[model samples]
Target: MVKTGISYSSLGSPDGTLPAPQEVARHAEQSGLDSLWASDHLATGAPFLESTVALAAAAGSTTRLEVGFGVLQLALRRLSWAAKQIGSLHALAPGRLHLGVGLGGVPADEWQAAGVPVAERARRTDAALRALPSLLTGRTTELPDLPGASVTLAPAVPVPPVWIGGGSPAALRRAATLGDGWLPAAITPEGVAEGLATLAELSGAAGRPVPRVTVTVFAALDGHLGGLSQDALVDVLHGQFGFPRELADAVAVSGPPELIAERIAAYAAAGAEHVVVCPIGGAWELQIELLGKARGLIA
Candidate 1:
């Protein structure tokens, strides 16, 4: 079955406020979401919780719902610190953690705040990905760049499946070579189909299995469900994300639950194994309940 999830770390509400992480998490689990995802950012220029902390809260509040970083900016922190955080979360959540890593899409000032050069993000992320396996498994791992320096985390837990985010060629290559899954956002069904085919070829070339696919959709249910219009969602996609207007209109999933389910099924037909809905309006709780109903229709 196609697993369905919701992104609770959204600032897309009409009033720019969100409920507590634990509350959203419990509600998602009760509402029948398979997982809950949180986006990571150091400085989003808006109200945003730290991803790790938010996921920790979610995980603590629910037993069945998987908690993940929709995409954590690995380069924003020292490799060791990143490993420590992942390891600690793994220890806490055990098999429930899904590690999603990426080079990030936040403003360059966030990178500057972390002392990470913008250009070095990809290199740092790749290095961090390479070193994570060892560090998280209690094996002595040499720190990246500091040859002699090494660290090992205790209470070692299995490294959660890593989903590499972004839809660029470089991202596809990274997912093919280093990730267990590929996560792309604001893309169309045809794009997902094409990306999966590319992933199969790239993974074969790398002598690795093809990665799983997950698509993060930005959406808002119409009527009494979530008070946001299709035009508003399209504008947010086109303006904030710089998607071409046409592409935004085609990709944005809005309107009633039936429409939402149909759009999600299209992605599933295109090869996505999972869909993470990041609802784009207020009435967050109602939107989540409605998303659950859509998931039921797909099931």
Candidate 2:
């Protein structure tokens, strides 16, 4: 059976109130979800918690539920500091951390504020991934672009599974070469099937086993429960999140629990090993309960 998870990002109430992270974490764990994910953003012109701190709160609160980054922008922080934060989290949570790395493009101002040129994100992300494992495990890893310079971090923990996040071809290449898993958001089942095939080919050429697949889908269970409309969800994806209209329509799973379960099954049939549902509407806790029901029907 494909594992199921939810993004704690949705815990921000429709009334603009954000729930306590530990409360959200405990609710998810009690809901029997497989994992809990948090979104990373330095600035998106909205209230947001720092991703690492959010995940730490989640991990500290739940015993069984895995905690992860849906996608973290590594280019915005110094690589060593990033490694240290991840290592520290792993020491606290042990085997429950899933690190999702990506090149963040939206809100270019955040990158500029971080002193990272927008164009350098991809290169910086790739370099970070290459050296991250060694750094996390306490090995002396050579710093990228610094000839003969290396750093060894103390009190190291095992490197968490790194999931490369993006729907683009370059992301697929990064997953094939440097990641333990692939995480793509707002993509359809057909897209998942096609991307998996491409990943197979790319990993084959790279002489590495194919990375595991995880799909983060935007959903709203409003048909029966009554909350956000499907059209509104699509608008959020297209207008707010920058997905193409057609792709957003094809990927956003809305309506009743049965309908949502069917979509999860489609992704499973397309070879996704995991699905992380991001509820776009409804009461956060109620929506999570509904997603747990959908997951139960996914076999």
Candidate 3:
């Protein structure tokens, strides 16, 4: 049977407001989602939820569903600290944890906030990667105590799989070299193909085993297809992918159940070991029903 997952994009309803993270999480878990995924963004002209805190609340509520940081903004925050925090949370959820890292946020603002120079981003990113492993292991290993005394996350759990998120070659290379999983966003199939190639190439060069490929898709499950409409699809594409309206609607998977299953199967055929459904606007009940039905199809 094909593996599947679901995400709570936690997109605030039509109005600008943040919902309780725990509610979204509980919904994902009850809905039979393989994993719970959330995006990390720094108030990007919208109501963005804090990834770690939100996930922590989720961990407190669910025992089965896997909790994930769908793409923590490594460029914007202290990765070592983030790792520690995630390590602690993993204890709550145990091995059902996934760390998805990504380069996000405005370069100028993120760097300025952290007092890091823009030109030095690549160096910082590399350093973050280097520092993350120790923190995840809760080994008490030190790395200049990034932004503070180097410390491990509390309530440590076994190391969880790390998934690198980015559509770029460099990102895929990093995922191949260091990550246990590969997760970029759902954009064009061409992008997924390129990312996978880069991951394979880097893994070979590093003599590492191939990492799992995880794909993300935007979906609204209240309908029979758990799909979104062309207009709603455009909204998500613009907000999530920044894709132009026409292009976003053209590629998004939104329709009744049969059609939605077809879209998900496409991803699996393209080499996705796990497909995360990033749910659009809706309550947990409807969302869970959609995922449960989708899971049945995939199973």
Candidate 4:
């Protein structure tokens, strides 16, 4: 059955201490969330963190509950290398990995620093997506020069579900044509409805199944999860994302319980197959409880 889940970017809440990734993973799984998703931001963690490693730990922590990269920038990584890494994870996690991809269009200086070119990112990403399933499935593909320099991936484990992310027209088309699902973030009711129409056309053109739709939405419930107020939550939204306060507030989702429920229903009505709520200001457990209750779905 379709399910509800949360996508946590890190182990800890904004304020203080956190359990190890494994512990957090167990708690989330035990809470009844069907899956766990981690953002693939290498630098976002203040101390030391990497997405895949934490997810590996999460995998070790639980026996069930699907785990995914909330988003990993395929555009920046080498296709062959990424295939090997993700393929190994798939072997370990078995049927639980969801490969979420995005361009992110990160700053050039950053990409250059990492030995990748910003201009070539999109093209490379497209190539990677096409090549990943093939390479990961144990067939050797040529990787330029150095003839016979083929690398077979770890194993042909359960094929990781690929979900594309981003909001551009091209991204929507990519999701419908090449992805198992679409993973969009910070989207609105109107935006989702419009995008789904595009997806339908793209799916028909590509002769693929009607693509599934998942979302990474910014959400907050009544009262303080940690110590931040609803208004403070709005500020965090605007500050972190550089979104305008007015528009951010429009999507912040606060106040009356009835409104929150209606908004969630509106999201489902707008074509979301699975919506991953991101509680902006709250204790992790509290966020889990409030959102799960509000959405009438278990964690």
Give Cα distance to truth, residue 224, candidate 3, Å: 6.7
lDDT (10s digit) by residue, model 2, range 124-231: 898889889889889998988466788999887888889999989999999999998899987889999999999999999999999889999989866566676777
Which of the two candidates, 1 or 4, achieves a greater lDDT against the reference? 1
CA error at residue 221 for candidate 4, angstroms: 3.4
Give me the runs in candidate 1 sitting further than 4 Å from their true place.
Answer: 223-226
> Which runs of model 3 end up more than 4 angstroms from their true locations?
107-111, 144-156, 189-194, 222-228, 239-241, 245-247, 282-284
Local error of candidate 3 at residue 117 (angstroms): 3.7
lDDT of 3 at 40: 80
Model 3, 1-299: lDDT tens digits are 45667666555676877667787777767766777778886656677778888788877888887788888766666666666677777777777778887766564655676766666665666677777777676677566425546565655466678888876778777788878888877555565666677777789899997788888877766544434665776797798668888667655666555666777777777777777776676665576667667777764
Candidate 4 ranges with C-alpha deviation above 4 Å: 15-19, 45-48, 144-149, 222-229, 255-262, 295-299
| Per-prediction TM-score | 0.96, 0.95, 0.86, 0.87
Give Cα-based local distance difference scores for all models: 0.88, 0.87, 0.71, 0.72
The residue-by-residue lDDT of candidate 4 on 233-262, one tens digit each, is 678889878878877776667644355556
Model 1 earns a TM-score of: 0.96
lDDT of 4: 0.72
Which candidate number maximizes lDDT? 1
Worst 10 residues of 3 by lDDT: 221-230
What tens digits encode model 1's per-residue C-alpha lDDT throughout 169-228? 999999999999999998999999999999999999999999999999988765444466
Q: lDDT for model 1, on a 0 to 1 scale?
A: 0.88
lDDT score, residue 221, model 2? 67
